[model samples]
Target chain A: MSPKGKTRIRRFSPVQRLFHVLLMLSFLTQGATGLSRMYIETSWGKGLASVFGGYESCLTIHKYVGIFMICWFLIHGLYLFFKIDWRQFPRSLFGPDSLLPRFEDLGQAIQHVAWMLGIDRLLRLDRWGFLKKLDDFLLRITRLPPLNRVSYLKEFDGLLSVITKPPRFDRWGYWEKFDYWAVFWGIPLLGVTGLIMAFPLFSTRFIPGWGLNVVFWVHRIESILAMCHVFIIHFFIAHLRRHSFPMDRAMFEGSVDLAAARHEKPAWIARLEQTGKLESQLVAEATPGLRALFYIFGYAAIAVGAFLLIGGLVNSPSITW
Target chain B: MKEAVTRVRLVYIGGAVGLLIGLAVILTVPVRLARGQEEVTSKIYRYRERVATGYYEGYEVSPRRARAILETPGIKRGLFPYGSSSAMVRIRARLPDSHKGLKFYYRNTCIECHPEQARNIHSVRAGITCRQCHGPEPIPAINHYYSAMNTIRRHSYVCAKCHEGATAAFASFYVHEPPAASLETRESFPALFYTYWGMLLLLVGTLAFFIPHSVMVGLRELSEHLSFSVPHTLMVGLRDVFKKLVFFMSHSFLAGFRKFSQKLSFFKPQNFLAGYRKLFKKKEAFKNETDNAP
Candidate 1:
């Protein structure tokens, strides 16, 4: 098979793909049912609510889906715990493959913003030195060694290699790290507040009389922020980006085009090839039928997300003004 | 492999149908309330029983009725021409001579039995006299008192009558009592008060930073991807978005119709029996094959 046709990079494991599907399903369900109740006064919200059998049913579905999400959230944590070779210990957490943010991610984020703003073009300055100093300072505070990017590029492919080489992010981008942690931060807050609100009488036994009010506010604000972030920012980064327009199949089929991987994740690709693990990572490309299924699921999720965001904004008080 | 894919698709269809049926069943189910207080207390009304605790055996309406009436609005202003607070003056003004022309008279007979309750804070504040809450006629309360007290212990039952919007803020909590007197006051629940403020700040701070960051990123992408001066590029981008929306809507509509038709076909007796037999028969055949292999 031609190298271009070969799916030689496994971007996601089958387990990870399964988790993604579950997350997508639960998140979309939660968003749809949640926004329906939140904006029930609006026509769109009302219509959506009636589809789910009115306000009471929306509440029921939201609660049940929320419980499901929290369960999966805990399960995901356990999955990660079990997957780790304890021998790798702290390395599993701090290593290049880790989702945890590192000093280099800050440099990458800065570089990205600089590139986006055209600041990088105006200055041929050794911006790396400045970033390295910042990274050193961060290291001093965080007490973690800087991650070294091991490149295995046998033959550099001109401009693609040059641009991707500068900020050689390993496995995960800084934004991707932010995306992962945002869920970590959000789920617990939403879950705790949701549970408190779910079982208020029990909660009130320990919480003060006014504790329910506080819990209510936290849940509302956090959920709204979450919906906006996921529907707009996360959606744009994951699917609507130039490279991944239409969809990012990596999370679905568990691989990306080796050529595309080389261009976008040069460091990760190079390391895999250098370690001679590249062949092991290879898998057959998804069949057309499977691809069709993925497209249906992906687009449905995107539509629901868009509906929630647009429907919410339509009735927002600020928009009326 | 093709058959496996078909089976997967069938499973998806069956799952969705099952979900819809489940939802229908749940929505149609009647709300079953807890047994009424009268039933719990064995048919004898609590107040009607000869009980003394340094207070009159106050006979208000049933718990359910009081709750329903409390939920009712504008009753205070409409019912009490002379403010509910000054029940004494209003009752005296309607004394003997004035009673002849009045449509309804204050039943001062209640205070005769329940004098101490008349001095209670809620009654005094709302100017609620006996008939105001107990009703001008006792017949309705007596009839329905045994039916149910479903609304009394409901979260925000009393407060929701007036504070409808605030009640919804914590509707999921399913609380059984009125809000605490302290509310958000720091003096009573300092920890909660601070946590609330902390959460508010976190929410505001995160959105403040991230929203602008997202906007900047969006703008940068637009600038990088499309040259706005070229009208063709803009047109192409918009056309792509429109095409996507059209494709999605039409595809979903068709898929829905297909599923509906499949469901309708499933109702056919032959198809139903065929499916049932095929499922179990295949399992049985597999069992025999395994037994023969061993």
Candidate 2:
């Protein structure tokens, strides 16, 4: 067979792409509804509330949207569990060689900050170097690392080595791990507080007279934190980063251009190239059942959207000055 | 793979059907569960009875009927007399003495039971007796003592007729200005009860925010034991708790502002006033110098 010299950028499976689209829409709706409620006294708040019907209707939609968000979180978690290769999964989490920051990563971060401030030129540390050095140093000093590392660190120097080495599918990158933990912690804090606010009866059972007030406080503070995190960290990494400006398609298209991947995730590119066997393995790993599940969820989401739209229309309050 | 596709299609159809049904049910269920006509009438009658009893107990009276009367289109204008005189009082005074006969006659004569109250009535204006407000004929079926007690209870309406203002009835009756000893005896009991209830709601709501979840659950359960007849008391407690939680959460953001202010007294009123005064003096001085200059 003739060697195909062109680098083939693998696209996201149809299911994964659909899931990403739905997830983004759900988050956007939630953010709009939540922000509207938070600033209910303002003109923007009134306009947003009117879009949902009225103040009370906006609140009702906010509650249901919250429930929807939680369900999405659960589905996403299950997808990670069922579809993602378990061997590849843990490496993303503990793989210091990827994007998981170490002590040296802090220096790189500081250097980048300085470059932004025009104090110094941007540093060109290797993709895995700073993070890998930090992970190794932390693991050596701590003795006890993550559960994934406890089993694999004996054979491998650290998660960095495993991720950077050949023969493993590089589809799941280090950035995915950072995003995972960020969401994992953020969702629970917001979810529990949100549930309390939404379900007053349930909250009152435990919270006493001040249950609503307490829920309100926690909900508002957590919301502010989540918004700040999304605006600063998530925005910076996803769009505002030097090379990723305009957009990064890896999150939505679930694929990166070879040149961009080489520049941003060089270790991942090197590992994939060294292991000629990795491509076939990844292709084989894609299951029809996973695609089927995505279709099911997509239909479910459409049904939910239609129901909400109908309910909103029928019960919409008459607006008066 | 084909089988999976078929399964997905089935699930999708099922989800759509289920959602439609759910939406239909949610929209209609509240209307269906609403009380029927007979039930609604009985409930309204019961509520009226409760309000009548509450009036005798000296609880704050609702002006629902009066409000309804006021809201009726053209009614207020129609009721208003062409002359500038107070129509309400004139109409009441002009009613025939024969029509003043009480529907529910009282057995107890006011003079027999509340001799002091009778004396006070005479002292204010001779011939102006309890019967003026309580009606001429007393209830022959009920106890005379109960009738006299009812008269004293209903006297609050007379007081309210003159002294009405925003929460002024409760405030004046309970927390009297230039305090009246005669009024004090009658007012203090209701005042104490109202104060206790208001504080209880506020305190319970506040406490619910800090305590463990189980403790809140216990408080909710405990509310059932607190009330005698109505489940409303428990609901009120729960509602207050929810309000408190919301208040606590919302005000938490203000804690940042509080901390900031504590660390540095930015825009303190005293400091602001001082700066304003200094600026005013400087401006005055400049104006004086300019005036003196050629």
Backbone clashes per model, in order? Answer: 2, 22
TM-score of each: 0.55, 0.37
List candidate 1 segments past 4 Å from native: A1-4, A124-166, A318-321, B1-197, B215-294
Each candidate's lDDT (Cα)? 0.62, 0.46
lDDT tens readout by residue for model 2, B71-160: 222223455544555553333333423223444325545566545454331223223555544444422211122332232233243333
Candidate 1, residue A205: lDDT: 40
Query: DockQ, in order, for the candidates?
Result: 0.07, 0.02
What is model 2's DockQ versus the real complex? 0.02
Q: Which candidate leads the pack in DockQ?
A: 1
Give the C-alpha miss distance for residue A82 in model 1, angstroms: 0.9
lDDT of 2 at B89: 35
Q: List the residue pairs that clash in candidate 1.
A: A197-B173, B84-B127
